[model samples]
Target: MSGETPLRVAFIGCGNIATRQHGPAFQTIPGVTIVAGCDLLPERAQAFTARFGGRPYTDLTTMLAAEQPDIVVVCTREDQHVEPTLAALEAGAHVLCEKIMAHTLAGGQAMLMAARRTSRLLGINYNYRFFPPLVTLKRLLTEGALGEIAFLSVTAHAFCFHHALDLLRWLGGEVVALTGQVSVAADPQVHYPVRCPDFVYVPSRAASVVVRFASGALGTLTATRYEHLTTRLLRLEVAGARGRLVVDGLTLDDIVGRLTRWPEGQEIPTGAGPERGFALSFQQADRAFVARVRGAETPAATGEDGYAVLLLERALVLAQTTGRTIALPSLTPVAEVGR
Candidate 1:
């Protein structure tokens, strides 16, 4: 928290994300130290600690008790998020959870409640919000560069549907209602690369959702894993009464091929270079979380935001199943939803 004392950080799941993004990003921060890494497999934990400089442990309870970390980064699989997050909060540590908050609404709600009960910050890694071009777009929207957003459309990979949902809420406004449709993989042999067979839930390979925002803005999100090209891993276009903005190409390493404004036919500089790539967004996200933990006012997705996205995911699924529009009350408490 102070310049003299480095914040002791620990990782709960030292798998792919921790190894690639979180570990590397934290290493670049000034006043943070990786104290421990915990994983179900000792070899994985050891491998993570070897590169990131931490003690390795196979048990989370043992690591939490021994290390007493200031912050816990939950990089576990989707279904595994809630348990470690709640545990970390109970152990008196703030948490930075990986996305898709949890596999279910109740799980997300439990994690949210735990954070409130412990009075510790619970930030979700909605890293796309930190993409420089998107950051500028948010600033422009706030300044009313586009007067009153009217419509938004997002195209993303099926794996990024949650990110698309988060973007809709972030760039547009609160969603009031939504309808959705999905195309499930017909072949039993076809499974998403990252999701394990034992995982509680696996998202569809392609899906579409239409939403009505509280600002009266209508939006559509279409996501599919069938696309072989990387040109539009994630693309967002927003239109307002005054003008329109388009941000194309949001991939892991290459992001924002172009950011352009309509009518004026002007190209906007994103101020992001190809060298850093989209991975810089993860660093930005990690830096914001660290700043918040140090008692600074920073913009990062909160537990409530994560819960709201999960709620929308649930609504979308319900809409697809029932073939009906789901109305979400803006004022409703997350805990009270789907009860």
Candidate 2:
């Protein structure tokens, strides 16, 4: 076993996310060897292997037995996450499964159980938690900078599963309960005919969710797909024991501490330098995975962490379905100071 050799990894999915986010970011991180690739689709596996330098395989079991990767990156669709993640854990490989966590509660539980049974690290790619500014804010929260942490307000839309899980995990603070409402608003103007074919229409959702954390902190998450442009608006207000702070346009996070204040109408400090791209957060997450593989660090979002997030997500969906608040399941707690 070449354990110390650049930690070998297999990419289980070769879709758009694997290409645009994970694949490109893997090229930037150190101590990573993307040794094998697999997908149900042979062409996608071949294409990914061609672009990223790996052996392409159609079956993950075969790939695992042959390549013997120390880590597996499961960037597959949310519905397809459980099987591969379970397989990898059973094979004694750590897994980084992309999020929502899974399509359903049962699927997510299976993955969690497999990880626990095998005692292998399982991480869900809740990448937004890695955003530099968010990390800084989390540190401040640990110091009780925000007076009482009265309420948390969030305004954003669907993030293709991966992005949504990150924000929920980061801001909610170990959710104890969830109540959600999903609404659809249709626009006749949204329907437009294509030049060569029939008509194409865009669909949108308006969701309002309320989450209560174990520490009594509350978060109100409102999502609507009616923005003028496709963008994310992440705003946090942590009212501490003495003062309050707000984080906006998180890309300029290096100057995070110098940002806005609470109670409104106060002069906000500005950060220097132009705000860069969102891709940086994804890169940070990939680097964290590599670091964990090398025993340099533990993953920010572990398999149990993934399970917790997925549990909350399931509760939210159930809340939406039954129009009632759902209680969070009991967690096998870990000892992480100031988390």
Candidate 3:
């Protein structure tokens, strides 16, 4: 899109993610201009705009009408995602929403419907897919370098449950059946140096889910909030008929301290180190969304993808409650299942 008119971008919910990830990311992109920042708190909006080169607004409608942005980035909390995203699409802008999509499947469905009605691009920021090591691993799998997948395993802190779930579906084929169980901390004396706010913390301290994929591959995901070490926040391992791939030590500022491949005995180094790698993932994701908006071919997670993950979440909960294997329905023509 060189020499083309720069894409005007606005942001809703100028919080930590907006300030730390999206704002910095757009600044590095070539054909994007930050036009406005909107937040309920006037100071937050003002502060975000001051640093990101955008005007500030306290209301979404006013921001939409005034800026008429080509893209709206929804950085609000998970529950507040639908309203701003729908408004942005309806007001004639593509939308890139933060993760979790929404608090409920109904809300996610509404956002998807609005995007469909408006015919505007709707992207979800599943930034983990942009990690350099994971990106390389995906390419290897796509190229059949790792024959037929047999089993995949993921272990992470509870905070990464959603991301792990998305990875399972992305790397392993569509899920066919799943069962899950959750455990609470037995010792009431568990403490943290810094506690998350009530809204930020999910109550489940530990959980495990087993899933069977449509391709007959098996997968397991285990997450626990009980650990106090930062040596490794997330680890993913996939075994195939030919070989296996392992990615270890993913955190907010770091991803893939080590990436190992079997048989070949090769170790891939994820460049840029911890200080820059994880943040680079966000930049890469934003760049992909920008390329998609420019009518270029790029890989990005869509609204439908986010909705599918939510469906899996619902199925997992049901499985845990009923102590029965829950079968996941196909999400094709998501509009049909969205409702």
How many steric overlaps are in each model, in order? 0, 8, 0
Scored by lDDT, model 3 comes in at 0.82
Model 2: pairs clashing at backbone N, Cα or C within 3 Å: 122-303, 146-239, 146-240, 146-241, 147-239, 147-240, 147-241, 148-240
lDDT of each residue in 137-201, candidate 1, tens digit only: 88888899989888999988766777889999998878899888877887655555454222113
Best by lDDT: 1
Clashing pairs in 3: none
Model 1 clashing residue pairs (backbone): none
Q: Write one digit per residue (lDDT tens) for candidate 2, span 1-339.
A: 434447787899998989888888887666677888899999999999999878999998999999989889998875678788889889999998887566655676677777777878788777767655566666667667675776666665433222443465565577777787766556644322211011001124566678887778777766555643233445555555566666665422232323456565453533323534656667778878777766676335776676666565556567767788887654332222113
Top TM-score hit: 1
TM for every model, in the order presented, reads 0.92, 0.81, 0.91
Instruction: Estimate candidate 2's RMSD in Å.
Output: 6.6
lDDT of each: 0.84, 0.67, 0.82
Better of 1 and 3 by lDDT: 1
lDDT of 2: 0.67
Cα shift from native, residue 236, model 3 (Å): 0.6
lDDT of 3 at 120: 98
